[model samples]
Target: MSINHDPKALQNPMHVRVAAAFRIVELSDFEARVLSKGYVSREDYDEAYLLYAEKMTAAGFRVEHLLNSQGYYVPNFSSAARDALVAKGDPAEEVAKFESEQWTTIQNCELGTFRLVNAIFHEQSQPSGQFDS
Candidate 1:
């Protein structure tokens, strides 16, 4: 069977959004399938998610500073936006929270997670005394 027959081709809305945002009309079958599922796979999700991050970053919007309380699902920050918020006498606590959250997200993106290696420990120690054998 050809990849064209895959059930998860990018839906209309997703295809439009992705195409507009990424500036590309063509996508590999795997990519279309991945985006259509709304981020089910880690690698695929990261690719799209990072694109969002890159666009926002380029626009001078801090992708991590958006707050849920402020009615933003995705984190976003900009110098202009911050200034406007601060002019309204924004609460210090909320600003701090946003910054903290943004920092955490940045760190996670910068340093990806890894699985720990499994190993066995032996309770063997070399003799401290002179090895006269």
Candidate 2:
């Protein structure tokens, strides 16, 4: 059975650029579309996990990352980051510290960072990165 379309290309490594050098979680379809198209609005970030998953899957994306219902990345840390990474303590406080520290590279303030963190967590969990938590 030969298909005329290249499905994998739709979610190629180029998309990793968004996940690299930052911690991010996959976004809602609304978020993914707006973000992929380079538009950041005051959108409510509304949408459920299933919807986000299905949208990305339909787009031919693997959708490795997942955000909690509250829109928080699970938490990704390395041995190097262990000392700096917030301990498994208060989620709010740790998130605040991370936001204050890496806002620029992470893109926006807390919101952008949280998204990044979640996405990165999902990606890094796949293979490399020898750092330990």
Candidate 3:
């Protein structure tokens, strides 16, 4: 499938792309699918998610933050449409459903989800003892 690049995808930094898909989906598959639709491969999505922890620090956003927030279902930060569901009453079940569907949708588009994802999770850092520097 030839990926059709969307203008908004440019607004999405490369690192966020990688972070959004990390563990949730294989990065290779994500890249391949997006490219087939004319989307660009953005490594910055990873940097935005992992390297720029400082910018999102004050907001309580971080890679490890959502790992424990029951998978960040409260806000549905994965996509704009999900935010609507997040705002609805009793959206817990809907949020989970959206996540499953997002994994499939994002395979085709670079969503602006990193900022929202980071917003919910607390910033994580290397373990106190793991710093080799």
Candidate 4:
């Protein structure tokens, strides 16, 4: 038996491109400032996470990427993502928890990156780089 792993078997190319574009929206100055702190509590982190996620959703990225709850920050998995994981034989509850945890980790990374970028900027009086428009 052979498994078909063709690229065409995946999502529509246009859909993929649109998704990529939405995810690539540049961080606004305010959002950048909020995440630039060296240390923030989970509560603070969630605030920034939701802010970024809201921007992404408004820009047309899937809403599934955002947290489903204000207090808990649970990740919202799209039906397609959930179905795919189940099809791979993973238990549904476990998969949901895993995905939610993964999103939390991703939020941590986002905050870290903001701090990192600020660190780089602070390392030199004059950081010089050109951003592509």
What TM-score fits each model? 0.30, 0.21, 0.25, 0.27
Give each model's whole-structure lDDT.
0.41, 0.39, 0.38, 0.42
Query: What is candidate 2's CA lDDT for residue 86?
Result: 55
- lDDT tens digits, residues 1-133, model 1? 3434222244434334434443444544544454454333445444545555665576455656332453222434555555666788889987777667655655444321110000000001222222122
Backbone clash total, candidate 1: 2
Judged by whole-model lDDT over C-alpha atoms, candidate 1 comes out at 0.41
Cα distance off (Å), candidate 1, residue 118: 32
lDDT tens readout by residue for model 4, 1-133: 3332222222334322322333533434443343334233455555555665564454334545433333334444244455577789998788989778656644544442333233233222233432211
Q: How good is model 1 by TM-score?
A: 0.30
Off by over 4 Å in 2: 1-12, 28-30, 35-109, 113-133
Q: Which ten residues in a row have the lowest lDDT in candidate 4?
A: 124-133
The Cα RMSD in angstroms, rounded to one decimal, for candidate 4 relative to the true structure is 16.8
Q: Residue 83 lDDT in model 2? A: 37
| Best prediction by lDDT | 4
Q: How much lDDT does candidate 2 score?
A: 0.39
Q: What's the number of clashes in each of the models?
A: 2, 12, 17, 0
- Per-residue accuracy of model 2 over 1-133 as CA lDDT, tens digit each: 3221221222334334544443334443334443453323323232323344444344333445544675543332122232345566547777677645543422332333235333433444443443222
The RMSD (Cα, Å) of candidate 3 is 13.4
Residue 101 shift from truth in candidate 4, angstroms: 27
